[model samples]
Target: MAGHSPADGPGDGPGDNRGDDRGDGPRAACVLCGEPTEYPAEIAGSPLCPRCAWQQAQRSACSG
Candidate 1:
């Protein structure tokens, strides 16, 4: 088992969401709910979580 899962750690406080990664890739918070995302917020450019990012992607008019 990973010794540093979010549930097992202290978690990123609201004021400290720097989208930094401890291990297993970079991490960022959801711009809407303040929840951690699978990818970094820098990519999203909006501090959005995976769920929100995916939702935004789906809502996009692009198909490629």
Candidate 2:
């Protein structure tokens, strides 16, 4: 017990407290929804809320 520490368990270490690992870069949440954004390179006007992005995709597919 004397050699134990909180960091030894899950969600207790420095890495666990830092949040998702999207590499060493700044992070921003979606504009429409409040979720973490990923694959920023593949997305356009990304960080868009899921609801808005889905609608945009639907419109694009329909027009094509």
Best by TM-score: 1
What lDDT score is found at residue 6 in candidate 1? 62
Q: What's the TM-score of every candidate structure?
A: 0.38, 0.33
Candidate lDDT scores, in order, read 0.66, 0.64
The residue-by-residue lDDT of candidate 2 on 1-62, one tens digit each, is: 89887777667344666555557464566876666666343456647656678887999999
- Indicate the residue-level lDDT of 48 in model 2: 62
Q: What would the per-residue lDDT of candidate 1 be over residues 1-64, giving only the tens digit for each residue?
A: 6576565545565435553455555577777888877665456476776677778888884766
Identify the candidate with maximal lDDT: 1
Model 1 earns a TM-score of 0.38
What lDDT is obtained when candidate 1 is compared to the true structure? 0.66
36: Cα error in model 1, Å: 1.0
Shift of residue 12 alpha carbon in model 2, Å: 33
